[model samples]
Target: MSAATRAPRTCSIDAGSVLEQSDGSASGIGGTGHNAAIPSSGIGGTGHENTIPPGGIGGTEHNVAVQSSGIGGTGHDTAIPPGGIGGTGHENSIPPGGIGGTGHEPGVPPGGIGGTGIVAAGTLMNVSGIITAEDYTKKQLQLAKGDQICPGDTIATNQDAKVKIQFADGAILHLLKNTEISLVDYNYSPQQPELNRSLIILAKGDIRSISGKMSKLNPQKYSFKTPSSTIRVIGTDFLVTHLLQQEGALDAGTYTKVISGEVSVQSTTSTIRLRAGESSHVMLNGTQSIITSGGGTCSVH
Candidate 1:
């Protein structure tokens, strides 16, 4: 036949036979009777023993013995193996959304678990005028009715200012005008009553205290201190006042008046116990004495 007038030759191959195309591509059937088509540009088909070229795109074959270098390959039970980049497969370590195995990593945005924030030793239950708290660093933070107070804080009030503090263990303290007090140490754990402790310093001012669980459960651990004396409670409600030496007015001493229960005031030289409606005075020179009254310097009501 002449070159341009020749009829095209046609041939037929069986199901398992190889068919080669002009573009250097081939199609065949594997031992399991699954068809495989390999193209010149490197695309592969599905079969049990299909061999994909180094840079070829693979098909969706179940239980694939080997993975392809190109994309879209699946493994046994349709699970992407450890290093697979993107899929909803169970074994896919690197998924599209997050990098972790299960939930988002710690400290991750919107909502991941990490830190325990601030803890309060007491709270200001009532406040009037300009009440402020000076922290350990001496930075003053303005206090409000519901502000939290921490240990090592010095709570001070301006002239005519007042504040009420409610401790974690149900103790109540009413700090009257021009008062300065420090929460030296306060540790209360209801589950462990034996460990309860409290220590407060009345720097200069008047305070009315209603003893709490710490004073009732561990009285030896609870105490109040002034420059002249240390006051220990016995499930008591008491008023304490520490006045500095002023011109000819109040004496420079620590005064204690018990409204209920009892309190023991101990100076450097002597210790004295007072019951309800009784009072005691401890001078800065460490002399202790009993007094008929607190001179109404502190109000019980």
Candidate 2:
């Protein structure tokens, strides 16, 4: 494919403009009425005559000033207390979303699992003009370069084929021919650490993975599920391939070779950790075993 024909991938995330209502309504609370400004009695007075004030011992609304007759009658004040809503002292917990949270709370499923928060992972770029991707969630199979790839997208390539995908997390995937893989769970919340996860499933064929920031945040949480087991990476660049064969015993169906950092492959039977320059394989019965030190080389095409 010519460079002119192959278009660049465009994976974009448009966080809808956060429309915050600055002027939320606050109900006004007025002071309760009816306070005795002066006592309705008389002590030993010097021939004093009683004079009734306005409202007759009843305080006026809004505000009223009352003075004592002579000796000792307390005046009343009708003012809203300090730190009240009319003033400034309130931290609202529940926002308008009603979802009400950073969403990282436990039992608050991360958006990666398709809970609520949704973001595009990346897209296949610089295609040969013949690459195809199957989006499982959307149930669509017409995807090429420049199209956004979500979490549940399954991409496949034909013989002598090659593809490259740059993820939102800055990770890269260099896939080879006859490759079948799925982007299982991908939630890249760079600002929200707790709501971040990346998972990939390798059904068949070979591919190379380069770790992104998401993997570096929680490497143990980033995983690759294979035919018989799962592999967890430690922010590493590695190659993994799954081969399809007729039902047979002792046949290695999945292979993992680490180029940098480390990888841990676990089967139902056992688990093996591999470092750089190390390799391992999983058999048909979900048994993981390290390959002997012979014919040791990273070869996946």
Displacement of the residue 200 alpha carbon in candidate 2, Å:
0.8
Would you list the C-alpha lDDT of every candidate in the order shown?
0.56, 0.51
- Model 1, range 188-240, lDDT digits (tens) per residue? 65655554667889999899999888888889978999999999999989999
List ranges where model 1 is wrong by over 4 Å. 1-118, 247-249, 293-301
- Provide the clashing-pair count of each candidate structure: 0, 0
lDDT at position 182, candidate 2: 83
Show model 2 residue runs off by greater than 4 Å.
Answer: 1-118, 246-252, 292-301
Q: Give candidate 1's TM-score.
A: 0.58
Q: Give Cα distance to truth, residue 191, candidate 2, Å.
A: 1.7
